[model samples]
Target: MEHPSNGLSIIGCLRPAFYDEESYLRGLFHNEDGDGYASDWKDGERLNFNSQSAGANICSTLYKLEIMRMELFSVYGVQSSISLQHFQDAEPDVLVHSSSEIIERFNEKGMKSNAALKSLCRKKGLNVEGANIIGVDSLGMDVRVFSGAESQTLRFSFKSRVTSGRAAEKKIQQMLFPRIQRKKFKAHDEGLKNLDSF
Candidate 1:
């Protein structure tokens, strides 16, 4: 059955405070919305993927999350973790040999919440979609999206990991209205600017 909120029903409402896994994933990798997963990975060697396929990194990440359970999920990647079997008996949902199912599910849910990220991009007139999210760190994330026929992934570094949805929305606003860049000077030169130089 589908989740009432249209997310991974398997891990339904186990933690209502951290509800909406899709949005959580999106926020986790909010950085990867516009590009492929691998290139943006800072520690590429750690991923240990044998194939360099289009969505391999994302697939690998999701696979690890499913297999390792929520305990070690945060250690691998993402700001938070959600155990699929938190409320039930432990059993493998998707095996390594056939990981496509888990990857597809991840893609579906991740994309569903991608709309919020896309809206952010649209307000900036970026015209991009949060195609797939690759990784999530404590501070920010990486997002994968299609740029024409090619896939390009970019990093979205946040000031901090969002603790709540409202906080996430506020952070997005902060991203939207970035601090104006200003010329820098030596410490001693800081107070030498003329009042009318503005």
Candidate 2:
């Protein structure tokens, strides 16, 4: 997935919920800061390095943090502080569908959210060749993008949780349109450089 200027890894709508700071801290047990993994269950957050750590370790720790967050919510019942906005459902032609519902409706099928997400991405002038919508939650979506031998999971958060598909698409457009323009401008500049070489 393209990295937008807004810092989102991928674009998708999030569900509404209030987040508890204490619960979030409780879940953050990695490195010396989090719970140690020296137990029978071997369940804990272990951070062997910090921001100055190696790139690979940093990536691993980031994923570990995500796990910690889910554990916090599941075991501690910590809800996000963010709330969802109520909106009337729109026609399917206007928007894809309620992302949460679409995810559920197509759960049995592999890569269920692919089509909807692809449409959204394309609308924002993004490349969706190797992009996959791995998971969609109330908070947002987990989008996995593959580039050659490397892949990355990007977390995209929504400003508000929208009920209808149109609202979701509109929200994404608002968040991404500006960033998409920047990306296009950069690409065009690079193309111009190549033209000079030719």
Candidate 3:
């Protein structure tokens, strides 16, 4: 039953745009007279998880999204508030999930779609069998290749979160010293001219 994997079938690429960052922030925190703030978030906490507090904050954020049904599958690349129950060609498909056989079929179809999606996923050593890395993003990557070049695109979400690093003062010193040297040379030239008058 392995048919071709349609790139559009991978689904849900643009739904995050639906998220209201300001509202989300407020929902996380629920402030009184000011802005929304998540409970227990300390100042200077890392945005991505590396420490215990950072990890806890991320978990809190995910918990909130889950409560909002924001983690479900997409319908035609748009986020579905309900599970895959009411798609075209198959309003009945949604009604069928209660049956164990239908549920298994649904699950199998999903797994197959995921397997097709793995055609797009990549890490350091893992490479797509017949694809080219065309783009990268915060959460995932994209590749260009399919049996039909026009078919089967993939967006591979990262297994680990990326964190940003701040520049250290020592590194800044290395960059500025050369500029300082040029300025000092011009000052020395002025000083030599002044010494000529003595």
Write down the RMSD of candidate 1 (Cα, Å). Answer: 23.1
Name the better of 1 and 3 by TM-score.
1
Q: Lowest summed lDDT over 10 consecutive residues: which window, candidate 3? A: 164-173
Q: Candidate 1 lDDT, tens digit per residue, 54-173?
A: 655333332223333433332223344555566357544223233333234345655434664565556645777345545433355445655466555556777766554344445544
Clashes of each: 15, 12, 3
- Look at candidate 1 and tell me the lDDT of residue 186: 35
lDDT of 2 by residue, 30-120 (tens): 3355333211111233322234333332322222212111111221123342221311232243223356564454444445345445545
Q: Select the stronger candidate by TM-score from 2 and 3.
A: 2
| Segments in model 1 whose C-alpha atoms lie over 4 Å from true places | 1-111, 161-198
* Worst window of 10 by summed lDDT in candidate 1: 1-10
Candidate with best lDDT:
2
Q: Alpha carbon lDDT of residue 184, candidate 1?
A: 28
In candidate 2, which residue ranges exceed 4 Å CA deviation? Answer: 1-97, 100-129, 179-198
